[model samples]
Target: MTPRIVYLATADARGHLMRAQLLVHALRQAGAQVDVITTSDAGQRFLAGFGIEASILSHHYAMQFDTRQNMLRGASNRNVLHYMVHPARMLRDLLRLRRTLRGKDILVNDSFHPAALFMGILPVARRKVVHVYGGSLREAVLGNFDGTKRRLFSHLFRHVVGWQIDAARARLEHDFSYAISDHAKGRDCSLPTPVQVAGPPPADGLNSAAIYLNPHFSDTNLAHALCEGIADAGLAAYCVGEGYAGNDGWVGVDPNWASRAAHAEVIVSAPGMAALSIAVVYGRPIILVLTEQPEQASNAKRATALGIAHQTVTWRGEAHDFRCQVRQAASTLRRMVPAPTAVSSGRLQAQARVDAWTVRLLALCGVQT
Candidate 1:
């Protein structure tokens, strides 16, 4: 029996969408049918690029931060203000969800969708909605906070934010919760869901066939810098992004970007939780995380601090410095043993956990894996 899975992912942050994508692939591999619903055009393109048709419902975005010179200054409280100012969006969102999702087969939430929050209250259960996290709120503050920011983060603010996380965890409590990595689980100590560390998913036979290397980017600015470096070096890397054009490298969208990332020789990326999780699953690829935002710098710092498989870089630094780091990363990667054996042991363990979820999800739908 093919289990029908409906994944509801919010696009405030793309990591959630990436996780939902992993779930979709895993479910389909197990012979399940899956559909995705999202609130961003970027999400739709991501799904379409990978051959996953997502229904787009452009809702008001949450967490619009004030960014300047490629740095996050602060987050806007517009979501709250909007609700207080006008209930139109909320009412519309509620009506659409209640109508379309009421009878759908098990819903999985990667973001804090109101549907997930209200599920347990209205004769429904948040446990019915699998909550996914690549990075938790606790990390957002603790990881990136400077001394002033830390001191300025009032007791009231801390209390309110902690309550929000706790409330979400309580609502979405389930026998198991999905964490992008063990590090995410470690940071989110309050998560009621016993965290299962899902390393980057296995290549699953999706080999990158002479397709040249794939360079991933969430930092479009850094992407341009890195691509410029590639061009200066006269290297031919595959640039992967919706609106990204390659310079000297070829620009093409591969549906299996994750798979390619897993098998690449060296990956130029950011240390965002999604990238870290992907690195864990991909194994052996030397990663040079392009640090731009505070959160990214923090993630990069932590990746290096924990001695996890990554190197950090500030792409905004001197372009020559950036190019030097790229060369250094590439050079270091060229030295590792051809095949991943010692590292494979850990990744295989993580893959087992992912497979365990696949089996459990199948069983949840009354199908035997």
Candidate 2:
């Protein structure tokens, strides 16, 4: 009998779905039957494109803020609560999942702990793998908050979110937890074990479609301001992972990168791991911007450290500032001397290890590794 794997990933952001899609492809190649669960319309569209069958985990959330954003006590706090009132529904759904996932061979939760924990409660023989991407395990290592504020937030986290994550991990018997960033491992104060770092996919394929990784909501003024900036910057911008819809210069998000990279001069968005990877692969200059989320801020910082692109404040609205930054980045490209067009040694080593680990995982799961 073929081993079956159920993968759960929240559609809170496109990154979650994107990573899960990759996992599905790899799992299928390894000869495992895969079922993916996602929560957003964007996730559904992406799954359709991959021809993967996916189930939508529906919930009513007002504003989707992750762990870092939960620290701020006022507006951000209000935003979190206003959006997090699905406690009863969440418990109910978890119970339902527990009943439904009674005998899967494996359950993979890619940054979707709630569903993972629920499935763990079932009397199933499946192994649980909690796959964490860049933002999943950030608190312990990147404690950039002030000392007093850190302590206070730590207390809340330990008592509240920390306990929840702990319970989820404990219940699920999470055998192997994977982290996307080697830079993020052993950093989170909450977990005892360092997550096995699985570096992202290599930047090799050239995407033809001009792509935009928009994590921001489409309606917000800030999102609008930034989208407009991107439109004005040059290439078309995608909003909410859809093709350019606005009358402004921005082209909505299109996954079909069929020809965008070849035609467009640049790809502008927050410095996300996936976007950065795409930029690197396509050799496109990125306009890194800080977004409302702290994790985004951190990612942007890392991208700048990696010499990836131009970084700017979250609320960069001045047209002149945008123009100057773009011009400067373009100038830098012009003056750039040609280095050996080879993959960096560090990246090559990382890729080799990750490939080995993927094989190991497939073998352990009896998937013909």
Candidate 3:
């Protein structure tokens, strides 16, 4: 029987949607029927960019972030609380989800979603759910409460999240390393971070730098600073991200961005798992533009420690300072020599990993490959 799968991807960052895109494409190619549900309209548009159709759940929740990319804890809490108490929207969306999942063989929850989490608590719905997430994402959720004044609330919420994870039929944790054996002993199987395979590098040679920022960095001044910085290094910038859509000079919503970045002299992006995975596979040196995002900050540290040719530039509200930092990072990374084996070896390993994951997923859904 063909496995019928419903993937629920939250759109807090593009990484979740990107992961969903790869997995959904793989599943469909393998003759599985896959339907996608996202938390917001932005996610719908993002999936659409790759020619994938996704429906938006009416009762969606989102984290609040400022134009500078700092998480607004107070605002986020209030928003979530409001959503939780709204009986009408919550009941309606839950019904929508129940209807969607009726004939599906499995429900894959990428990262987290409140509605899915709630459904996982039900005995009937819990059996069909398989939660997918990365190590950084797990850390980010726990790290958010670290050192906060609300210690009791933080502890309780952590336990709540733990319970939700325990409720899933299975958990698939993915990372950006070759060591999948270490995590194969339990329900939590660590797979390689799934990313789209890159085509051959540009025949014309590396011509420009690729910059990708997520929608959180909506400050126009930051975009201007980034453009100036890349120009200062005498490299043309091929910028991607909804945040840069308003900037007339940058390319926005390019579905072929990974290919473009594969040909870049260097990749400049926020250290989201999707972007980082692409950089590693393509063997491109990267400059991680950091903000107050805890997950991204932790990811940047890990990437640097792992010996990736990586640099970091934290925003401090000064356009001039940020511009200078980007210029310096870009200039330095452009001169670094990328390993010859990095591209070919990484690409092959990544493909193998994704294939392994696809097979496992199919088996979990009772589909004979």
Give the best candidate by lDDT: 3
RMSD of 2: 7.2
Error of 1 at 349 (Å): 5.8
Total backbone clashes of model 2?
20
Model 1, residue 78: distance off in Å is: 3.3
Off by over 4 Å in 2: 61-88, 113-129, 135-137, 140-153, 159-211, 215-253, 258-265, 280-284, 309-314, 334-368
lDDT of 2 at 52: 68
The runs of at least 3 residues in candidate 1 whose Cα sits more than 4 Å from the true structure, single-residue gaps closed, are: 1-4, 28-33, 62-75, 83-85, 118-127, 135-138, 141-221, 228-236, 246-252, 292-295, 338-353, 360-369
TM-score of each: 0.69, 0.66, 0.93
lDDT of 3 by residue, 1-369 (tens): 889999999888888998888888888999999999998988898999888999988634899999978889779878777777788766777788889999888889888777777787788989888888888887787656768898998898888877888787888888765454633535667777887766666665445898888888889888888878988988887778787785766655877777777667889888888788878777888889887777778788889789988888877889999999989988999897777676677667667766777887897798656
lDDT of 1 by residue, 1-369 (tens): 458777788765555566566567778988888778997776777667656789865456454532212433344344644642466765566556556655555666666554454442444443344444435434553333344555565555555444444443222322112343332222123222221233353444432211222223333555556655544543445555533445334344555555555555455555555556555544644455443355556566656665665555555556677766665655555455435553355456446655655665565566865
Ranking by lDDT: 3, 1, 2
lDDT head-to-head 2 vs 3, winner: 3
Q: Which has the higher TM-score value, candidate number 2 or candidate number 3?
A: 3
Ranking by TM-score: 3, 1, 2
Least accurate 10 contiguous residues by lDDT in model 3: 177-186
Instruction: Please say which candidate is ahead in lDDT: 1 or 2.
Output: 1
Clashes of each: 1, 20, 0
